[model samples]
Target: MLIIPAIDIKEGKCVRLTRGDFNQKKIYLDNPRDMAIIWRKQNAKMLHIVDLDAALTGEMTNFEKIREIVTDLDIPVQVGGGIRSVDAVKRYLDIGVSRVVIGSAAVTDPKLVERLMKIYRPSQIVVGIDAENGIPKIKGWTESSGLKDFDLALRMKSMGIERVIYTDISRDGMMQGFGYESTKRFAERAGMKITASGGVTNAEDMKRLIELQPYGVDSVIIGKALYECNFPCQELWYAFEEGITLDHNFSTARKK
Candidate 1:
């Protein structure tokens, strides 16, 4: 399974919020591009980025900063947040983003997703299903969409969406462990490949997720755990980067 590091950008800085609560946020780095480079240097296979500001406001407030990161990184970077229109999707893909994740718009505007599906390859588009108590939430998890998570997943499946980034809001950023059973159930019912997100505490959680690989849980996006160095492998990477001289093109190597 791929361990994807998450970079949540708010006001052009890298930050992570607890349980999707804007007020309960903590800044990790001042420059998100630097953080992305750090992850790349650490041998991250793929990067996951979210625009917290855009997620809440529906505006690409940090587009320039995100663009900078995309330009500098050699690895595939998938981005999510405030992607409500076809133009927004185009802008990201045009700038070399590997994939664009559709969130609230998947609930509010199914046609937009359909239009995107028609325009882009299925691998280039994904839906983010953020849920609380089994009910899907939208607008940065601030409003209830009046639909169950499974229901929304099924709807998206019917709309030609083959993969989803499933996030259980209650477990997000708490470091209590991810919603393993919930994620497993969602994968089983939806029959779609899942990139599990939120509340992944440590290596043990990763082990648990690996067991679900047979159910189409291919990759996971970890935010707080990665930033805080929860994995022992991160320490090794840090020490190696600090002790040795790394080739400038080392991070550009494409390896799974």
Candidate 2:
């Protein structure tokens, strides 16, 4: 499974939100491109980026910053947030984003997905289905869509959307642990390939997610765990080359 790091851009900076609350954001880097470069250096195969400003207001707030990150990294970068129309999706793809994720647009306008899919290959499209209490939330998790998360997933699948980024908003950025039960159940019912997000705290979490691969959970988007070193540190990549054993009790790469 690919463990992708998230570079959530709020006002052109790297940040994380608690439970999708914009007010509780924590800025970690001034230049999101730096974080993207850091992840690439760690041998990450892909990256996930969310435009917070666009998510809230449906604006292209970080297009330039996103463009720069995609240009700097050799790996694929999938971008989401405020990509509601075909124009926005085309813009991102035209600018070299490997994939474009649609959230509110998927929920609010199912036809748009169909339209985009007709123009682009399914591999270039992804639907971000972020939920709380089993119900999907939109408009940056501040509003309810009144749609059952599983039902919506099924609907998207019916629309020819084969991939989804499922996030349990309640567990997002909390670092407690992934919501395995809810996530597994959602994946089983969604009947589509899912990229798990929210509350991925450590290597153990990655192992457990591996166990859930059977349910169509293919990849995971990790945020705070990576930034805070709750997972096995990126240093382990080099340690593996040095023939060093990285145990649970081993000293971490980060000083904190």
Candidate 3:
């Protein structure tokens, strides 16, 4: 399993929202570029970036800064937030983003997914499906789309989207662990590469995700765990690199 790190940008600063609640956010760093550099030094292979401002406002508010980060760093970046048009998708790709994640766009203007997939390869386009209580959430997780998470995943598959970064809004920033059932189920239905996000408090969460490998979960994203110093990125990376496949403690009691 691949271990990825996330950098959530709010007002151009790197911040992490608790339980996906905007009102409860913690600023981890003022300069996101500095955080990116730190991850790079730790041998990070890929970077996950979310423009919180853009997600809520439907504007590419931090593209300029994000563009600079993408250009300055050697690591590949997958960016998300308010990406609602083919033009916006093209803009990010033109600037060398490895993949563009469409969240609200996937629910509101799904045609964009088909159009983007036809233009760019499936690997270049990633659909971000964030949800709570099995319902999809949009606009930075502040509003509910009233759509089932797996239903959206199946739709993306039909649109020729082969990759997704699934996040559970309820588990996000809680540092309790990932919503493994939802993520694994979505990956199973989509039959595509999935990068799980939200919570992920420790290495055990990662191991749980790895146990679901048969379900098509390719990797996972670690945010609060790493930012708050609860889990070491190197340890997770080494475990995956060394092929240490430990059994996950994914009992029903643990799901809650």
Candidate 4:
């Protein structure tokens, strides 16, 4: 299973919103690019980035910052947030983003996904299903799509979407625990590979997710816990690099 680190950009700063609540955000790093380098130094296989400002406003507010991180990191980076149009999707991929995650568009514009699938390989496009109480939420979790999570996942699967990032909004950033059952059910019903997100607090949560790997839950996106050093591994990494400067160009052997 892949342990992906998440860097959510709001107003050009790396921040984490509690329970998807924009009003309750905590800034972790002033420069998101630096945070990306730290994750790379700590051996993150893939990095997950979300432009929170764009997610709510539907504008690529942090595009330049994201592009900078993408340029600096050798690891694959998957980005999501306000990627509503085909042009926006192309823009991200054109800049060498490994994959572009479609969120609101996946719910509001199903045909857009169909059209994108024809142009881009399935591996290059991902659908983000953010849900609250089984109903899929769109536009940065501010509105509900009036469709169940499973329904949305099934719809994307029918459109040839091979993988989805499933986030349970209620548990997001709470650090209470993960929505394991909800994620498992979504994967089982949709019959597609899932990258679970939201409220992954500690090692027990990770262990639970590992148990569901057989059900198509292969990886997870962790934000707050990682930033706050919820895992022991992070503690060690931080201690070892406390005074040492990081070489941003440091590279990991690419996984085959």
User: In model 2, which residue pairs have backbone atoms overlapping below 3 Å?
Assistant: none
**lDDT of candidate 4 at residue 213, scale 0 to 100:** 79
Q: How accurate is candidate 1 locally (lDDT)?
A: 0.88
TM-score per candidate: 0.91, 0.92, 0.91, 0.91
User: What is the overall TM-score of model 2 with all chains considered together?
Assistant: 0.92
Predictions in order: lDDT = 0.88, 0.88, 0.84, 0.88
Q: Per-residue CA lDDT of candidate 3, range 1-256, in tens? A: 8777899899999999897778999998999998999987666788999998999998999998798889889989999999999988889999999999999989988888888877899889999998888888887787888888888888888888888788888898887888878777777777877888888898778778888888788778888888888855565576776543333442233345
Record all residue pairs in model 3 with backbone atoms less than 3 Å apart, i.e. clashing.
none
TM-score of model 1 (CA atoms): 0.91
Local lDDT at 109 for model 2? 94
Residue 78, model 3: Cα distance from true site in angstroms: 0.3
Error of 1 at 159 (Å): 1.5
Q: What are the per-residue Cα lDDT tens digits for candidate 1 across 127-171? A: 999988888899989999999898999999898999999999999
Candidate 4 achieves a global lDDT of 0.88
- Tens digit of per-residue lDDT, candidate 4, span 64-174: 999999999899999999999999999999898999999999988899999999999999999999998889898989898999898888888898999999999989999
Worst ten in a row by lDDT for model 3: 245-254
